[model samples]
Target: MGTEKKEIVGMIRGCIKTVTCGQKLDLNHKSQNDVVKPLYTKLAYVLGLRVSPFHRRQGIGFKLVKMMEEWFRQNGAEYSYIATENDNQASVNLFTGKCGYSEFRTPSILVNPVYAHRVNVSRRVTVIKLEPVDAETLYRIRFSTTEFFPRDIDSVLNNKLSLGTFVAVPRGSCYGSGSGSWPGSAKFLEYPPESWAVLSVWNCKDSFLLEVRGASRLRRVVAKTTRVVDKTLPFLKLPSIPSVFEPFGLHFMYGIGGEGPRAVKMVKSLCAHAHNLAKAGGCGVVAAEVAGEDPLRRGIPHWKVLSCDEDLWCIKRLGDDYSDGVVGDWTKSPPGVSIFVDPREF
Candidate 1:
């Protein structure tokens, strides 16, 4: 929003521009030889483009996107990206049909209830909190294992809202694995696992307060009443699922990374740990965003599927040289491109 000043607004008659650069994003890192190479390109993110309803259908959207593309080109940006809901036809058409952008990826933003449902915690894995300097260890471990991991490790570790960084590994295996268990006891690393995971918790109560909508009056009343009882009568353990009424108090996990066959198990352990932290902080839910095909999406225990909680990612190339290996044509991008979404950018 800081980019919305007078000169740029006057040029577009009422448009805004936001450009971000100087971060390296990994496109494809999966290799048989254990050598991970990155795409190494600068990204320009264009968001908050709006055209008043009174000025609709007058090629305003097309002109706005064109201006941003030109600006990105002049500023040495190789890629331009945007995100929106999958069902937004108007915005979709403006980007794909007019702006020459390609449908790059569709990622699932999973949300988990902190206390309502059961979370299966792993006994073999132990999650421990780390100091700010230990954040470098997390970056190195994940970068060696997971693909599409962001290169901006310092920003995540030093963010104002970052609670801490945590790593999940086999218990009692001090090869950088720390001690302590959540909710119960654990055993030593006897089984020589294949993978590990690292996660960072970002308190989102001040940022991501959901506003429940489209519920009947009676339903809203029932949801609130049930929540009150659930809080009061802990022994009864009544099913107080979140609905369109309770919308605040959330903690989000970013930089979810994992590898190997047992990667999903490590992810589950981290989810349980993050959930407990959120509950202690008086939060209602825990959430994260993962690419639709990433194992972390299947690894983390999330809300039931088909919950209308997914986002559409679209990208366009600003530079003429397509040597970056990004599928220039949207139709040509099979199975979608691998992506990493930095929560700080949101």
Candidate 2:
């Protein structure tokens, strides 16, 4: 029995790489170089190769990456990609020039104040808390907008975590007046107790005002009906529904990141609504992650670049037959694109 247990342990150890950390390594005896390798799994990401500084410019980097690509292909990665800073010329050259990886997507992080005062008073819109029954209506509006992931609506109904979702109905519409104006022209205003505090206060106030305004008669009717249902159906014991005046959060995965007119309009409405919610919710800050370049930084001079970090780029070769493609405007092609979100989130 002891011998059998030892054998099992040895086999398990051999099957998995021994490591102080989770990262993998490639040993090149021919070149006498140690290459830090990226391991690819169906669920895990494959990171890019990092050559030792001492072995720099010796073609080791290329060799190591090729090996990693092979590993990815064998593990069945549908696609692989790499990311580098816009300023890092050498790394960029190696990937695009030598390794033949094309530009996939650019991601940036943007923040907005939740307070009314931080936002331009002229562009302010209203935000409201939603009830469970409102989920279907919100879903329809979101789908019509074509601005979010398809699964988002389902996820909402299923009761996910602290994720706050809301709808931006314009003031006169059946949904009510949502945040108006584009965020591109709007500037991020800074306040004391940090910016987030001010934004939260603003959201709470804005939500209260919208509720008092009776901006949408249909919404008011719905609210009253919902109340009647709650009182009559004692067994239901439903959760407290969010009123129209409460501000909420928005998460945009794809549609609003670009620079086209539609993208701008969507972002504008989103920001306006987000600001209103922030004020009404009395939440201090509203946050958004923008891809490509920092539009607010580039467009608005006063907005500062807070922090930037590169996500790890990993790839493994799934098959020997794979080819990235003949270059020249690969973004138009289907396989030419790659989408990445945090593994934990996915």
Q: For model 2, what is the alpha-carbon lDDT of residue 273?
A: 51
Clashing pairs in 1: none
Per-prediction TM-score to the true structure, in the order listed:
0.75, 0.39
lDDT by residue (1-346, candidate 1, tens digit) is: 4775543331232111222221233436564544434444556667568777767788877888788778777777667777888999998888888888888767887887666534446878877676766665546443422333455666667888889887677665553344333321112122324666778898888776776678788888887788777777866756565553556678888877766677778888998889878878778778888778776777776776413356887887666553345534333445522344566655
lDDT of each: 0.65, 0.36
In model 2, the runs with Cα more than 4 Å from the true position are 1-64, 105-124, 128-162, 177-266, 272-346
lDDT of 1: 0.65
lDDT of 2 at 152: 38
Q: Against the true structure, whose lDDT is highest? A: 1
